[model samples]
Target: MFNNVYPREKYLKKIRPFYDSDIIKVITGIRRCGKSFILKAIMNELIDRGIPKTQIIYIPLDRRGYKNIKTSEELETKIESMLGDDENYYLFIDEVQNVFGFESVIHAYAEEGYSIFLTGSNSYLLSDEISTKLTGRYLNFETFTLDFSEYLEMKRFFKKKIDQDIYVEFEEYILNGGFPKTIEFDDIQARQTYTRGIISEIFEKDVKTRKRISNVPVYERVQSFLLNNYSAPFSLSNLLECLEKEGYKTKATTVRGYIEDLKKAKIIYECNRFDLKSKKSLRREQKYYLSDLAIYFAMNTDNRLSYGPSLENMVYLYLASQDYQISIGKIGKLECDFITRNTSGDYAYIQVTYTMQGEDIKATERIKEREYRPFRKIRDGYPRYIVSLDRFRDQQEGVHHINAIDLFLGKEKI
Candidate 1:
C-alpha cells in the first residue's frame, strides 16, 4: 500500500543474499537515514519475487497503530495476531528497539521458522540481549544517508528540480545533505528546519529517553561543542578543559560517556589516527565527522562552507558509505586526508582539497606538493589520490588528481 518508496539498491544487495536464509537480518543506522524505507523496499522485493503479500508481515512499531505496543508481551501478542499458519513467512520490524524485552520475542520468532529482518536507530539495539541471545544467529547490515549519487538519483525519482551545473549540485548536496525526506522540501530554510527537527528527535528519542542523560544541560553543551567543532581533532583533556571553561564542570568519565553516546546516536562518527611509521592505529587525538554534512549546517547559523574541512567531511562520508574502514593517516608530521581499507582488504590513501587552483603557478606547485608529499612517504603500491573540486583532472607521478563531484557521483573510483 506504500507509494513513492524509492528503492535502496546498495542495502538491498547486502540483504538479498540472506532474503531466504534462516538467520535473522539486523539493520542499524542513524535516525532518518532511511532504515524504515529499506524495510519497505525489502517487502516490495519479496512481493516481486512471488512471495505472497500476506505472507510478508511488516511491523513498524513507531507508527500510529503500533506505537502503543510497548512491552515485549504486547508486541508478541500483536505479532501473533498478524501471523498465519504458514512457515514461509517473511517478517520485518522497524525500530524494534522501542519494545522492551524485544530480544526474546524476536529470537523466539526466528527460532519458529520466520525469515526475520529488523532495524534500530542506535547501537543499543545490538547491545545487552541481542549480543548474547541472538549471538551468531544474525548478520548486521549498516545503513547510511544517501551518498551523493543517490541524492541526485532520488531527486530525479521525485521529479524535483536539479541544478544542471555539477558544482552547484555538489554544493547543494553537502549543504542540504542526503536525507531522503529532506528532498521533499522546497527551500533551504525548510530543509534546515527539517534537519534541525531530526537532531532534536535523535536526542529526545534515541539519547535522553533511551540512553538516559541525567545532566541534560551538560550533555547538550558537549553536543554543541562537538557539533560546532566537527571534523577537528580534540583530546579528552582538551574537551574536559573546554567544558570547565564554560562552567559545565563535569568529570572525565562523564564527558567521555557523552561522546560515546553521541557516537552511538550516529550524530558524530569517530575516526582514529593511524601512524604509518608505527604501523598502528592510535587510541587518542581522534577526529569525529558528522554522519551527514547537514548535521553541522543545521545546528549552526553560519552557512558559509569551510571548504577544507567541509571537503574532507564529504570525502569521509563517501568512503565510509562505500564500506571503507577509514583512519587519519600520519607520517611523522605530514598527514594524509584519509587512509582507507575496503572489505576486501585493499588499501587506498586519499587527500582532499576544495580546489587546486592558486593565485600563481608557484602557489599551485606548493599546494600540489603538500597534497602529494604524504603519498610519497608511503611506499605502498596501493592507490593514492588527491581529490578536489577542480573541473579538470591531473596525473602526477603515481598519484591521481580527481574531481570531488566525480568521486561522489560514482564516475571515478580510487
Candidate 2:
C-alpha cells in the first residue's frame, strides 16, 4: 500500500536483521519524522510475507480511539481481546509512550510470545525504567527526517526535477529541509507553513507539555537562539549571555535545563568537542545542530547567516543517521566540523563548507588551508574529507575534497 511512499530502505534494512527476534523492535525519533509511517510500512511488509492481517494487532495510542486506554490494565485488556487462538502474533504499537505503564504491558506481551514493535517520539522511551524493564529483550532503531537521497526520491515520485545542475537540488534541500510532509508541498509558502506547524507541535507537545515548562516565552527564546546559532560552538554561559542581550532575563541553570529538554525531545542534537591530540572529550563549549534543517528555517525568517551552518548541520545529520559516533574535532585553536567513528573502529575527520567553486588564488588557498589544517594535524591513517558545494574533486596530501551533492546522493563515499 505504501510502495509509492518514500521507502526508508536504510532504516528498513536495519530492522530486517531482527525481524522475528525475541527482542522488541523500538523506533524512536522526533515528531512527524515518519515514525508512524514506518510502522505501517513494516506491517505491509509482513502482510506481503504471507502473514495474515488478523495476526497483526496495530494500535496507535495517539489516536482518539485509544486515548482512554491510559493504564497497563486497560492496554492488557485491549490486547487480550485482539489476540487469536494462534500462538504467534505481531504487535505494532505507535506512540506507546502515550499510555501509562506501557513498559509493563510490553513485558507482559513479550512473555506471551508476541513479536512487539513500538514507535515513540520522545527519548523517555529508552530511559532507565524502560531499559531496566526490557534489558536484553529490546533493540532500538533511531529514525530521523528524510535524508537528501530520500528527499530526491520524493521529488522523483512527483515527476519533479530541479535545474540540470545538481547544486540547485542541493540548495532546495538545504532551504526547505527533508521533512516528509514538507516534501509534498510545491509552493514555498505552503511548505514553510507546514514546517512551522511541525515545529509548533514539537514545542507544544514534546517540549512544553512533556517537560512541564512554565516559562514558555523563555523556552521559545532559547529555542530560537539555538536555531539561529546552529552548528556553532557555545557554552551554557554564552547562551545565557545571548538570551540576556535579547532582553530575556533567565538563569544559567534554567537555560541549561531548557536545552536539555530540547535534546530529550529530539528537536536538537548536541555534539561534544573531542580533543584530537589528547584523544579526550572537552567538558565545555559544545556545538548544537537541529534535528532537521527545516526547524532552523521555520524558526528564523532570515536565511542570510544560515547557509554555511546549514550545510554543516546537514552533514552532521547525515553522518549521525549512518550510525557514526560523531563529535566536533578540536586540535588546539583549529576545529573540524565532524570527527566520526564507525563500527569498524575507523575514524573520519570532515570539514563542511558552503562552496569552494570560485575565488582568487589567495582566497582559494586560504579556504583549502582552513578546511584541511585540522585533518593534517591527526597522525592516524583514517580518512580525512573536506565536503563542499564544489562539483569537482581533488585529493591533496591524503585529504579528499568531495562535492557535497555527491556525498548526499551517495555518489561518493566518505
Candidate 3:
C-alpha cells in the first residue's frame, strides 16, 4: 500500500525511541487518516532490519474471517496456528476492535516474548479495554494528516525550491486540509466530493455504530452545528434553543451526551477554559475543535475555514502532537488559544491568531499583558507564547511570538 509513497520517516523517528520496549506499539488516529499506513511502514522497517518473513505474524481483523472471532481465546488459537513453536515472533494486528477481548490476547502475547503492534481508527479500541489489560505495556502514537512541510515532501513537484509558490500552495492546503486521499488528488472539486463521501462513512461507522445513536437526524444536525461553529463557547441552552429553532426536538442531556461521546471517540475534541488564578479547570465555558478540518469542509457547504478558529485548531493539533494536556486559558476576559502542560510538571500558554493586524492588534497585545499579570499573582514561572501568521522576527511582547508554519515544523517558542 505504501508503494512509491514518501515514507513517513519523521513519525518513524518519533516511534524509534519505543522500539524493542516491552510496551505494545499502539498506533491510533481518526478514520482514513493513515494509521494503517504507519503500521505497514513499521513492517517495512523490520524487513529492512533483516527480520525474516517467517518470524512476523500480521493480521487485519477488519476482514470477514476475524469479524466473528471476537474472544482472546480465538486470537490465541489463530496465532498458534499461524506460527507453531515460534518462540520469538512479531505480531501485528490492524483494527483489532473487530475481535472483542483482544487486548487480553495482546497482553498474553506480550508475556510470551512476542512483540505486538496494534492499530485502530476508533479511540474505544484502546479506551478502557486495552488500557486496563495492557496497563504500562503500551506506547501510543497518533497519526494526523500531512503537515505543510510534509505535504511538500510528498509531492515531487517542489523538490529543490521552497518559496512564495509554496506559500500559495499552503493556502490551498488550509482550505482543503491535509488528508492523504485529498492530497493524492489535486482537483479541488474532487477533493471536496471525496471529503463529503468520507463524512458519510464516518457518520455510519463512528457516530452511528460507535456512538449507538438512535436519533440519527438529531445527531447529524448537532454535528453540523458544531462544525459550523468550530471554536466558540457553546452553552447547552444556546445549543438546545438553536436545535429547537431548527425544528428538531431533543433533550439537552441527549445533545450533550452525543457531543461528549463523539469527543471521547476522537471525532471532536473539547477544550475547557483554564483559570490561571484560582488555578482550576472550568467546564461551563469551553471551546471545541474537530479532529480533522475535513469534517468541517464536508459538513459545511461553504467550505471556508474561519481564520482565527482555524489557527486555534492548528495550535490544538500541535499541542496534542507534543503529548501535552491542553485547555483554553482565560485570564478575566482575555483568552489564550491553548494552555498545555508537559510531563515535566510545567505549563505554557499559547495564543493563536490568523493574522495579528488591524484592530486585532490591541486585543492580541492584551492577551500577553494578561498572561504576565496572572503568573505574577501566583509567582509561577510558566512560559507564554503567541502563535500567529504575522512576520514578526522580534515582537516586543514578554511572551514569545511564533509563526504558525514554524510551530507546525516543531519550532515552538517559549
The model with the greatest lDDT is 1
TM-score of each: 0.97, 0.95, 0.88
TM-score ranking, high to low: 1, 2, 3
List ranges where model 3 is wrong by over 4 Å.
63-74, 157-164, 359-379, 411-414
Clashes of each: 0, 0, 0
C-alpha local distance difference test of each model? 0.88, 0.83, 0.73
lDDT (10s digit) by residue, model 2, range 1-414:
345655688899999877776589999999889988888888888888998887889888888888788898899898888888776888998988878778988988888778999998878677645787888888889999999888888778777766677667777777787788887788876887898898888777777666788688898888888877888887787777777887888788888889888898898899999998788999788999999887776666775445688888888898999999999888988998888998787888898987764478888888777877787778878888888877667678888888877888898887
For TM-score, the strongest prediction is 1
Number of clashing pairs, model 2? 0
- The residue ranges of model 1 lying beyond 4 angstroms of the native Cα positions read none
Per-residue alpha-carbon lDDT of candidate 3 for residues 1-414, written as tens digits (9 for 90 to 100): 235445777678888776566579988877777777777788778887887777778888777676666787888898888895555788889887767778778887788768888888767777756787778888878777776667666665334333466557656767777677676675777888887787777667766776678687888788777878778887878888998998999998899888866775577778888787668999876888877776677666686557778777767876776678998777766666677888786888766667655467788676546444443433456776767777674365356778887777666644
lDDT of 3 at 1: 26
Q: Which ten residues in a row have the lowest lDDT in candidate 1?
A: 124-133
lDDT of 1 at 119: 96
Task: Compose the digit string of candidate 1's lDDT tens values, residues 271-295.
Answer: 9999999999998888988889898
Off by over 4 Å in 2: 1-4, 158-163
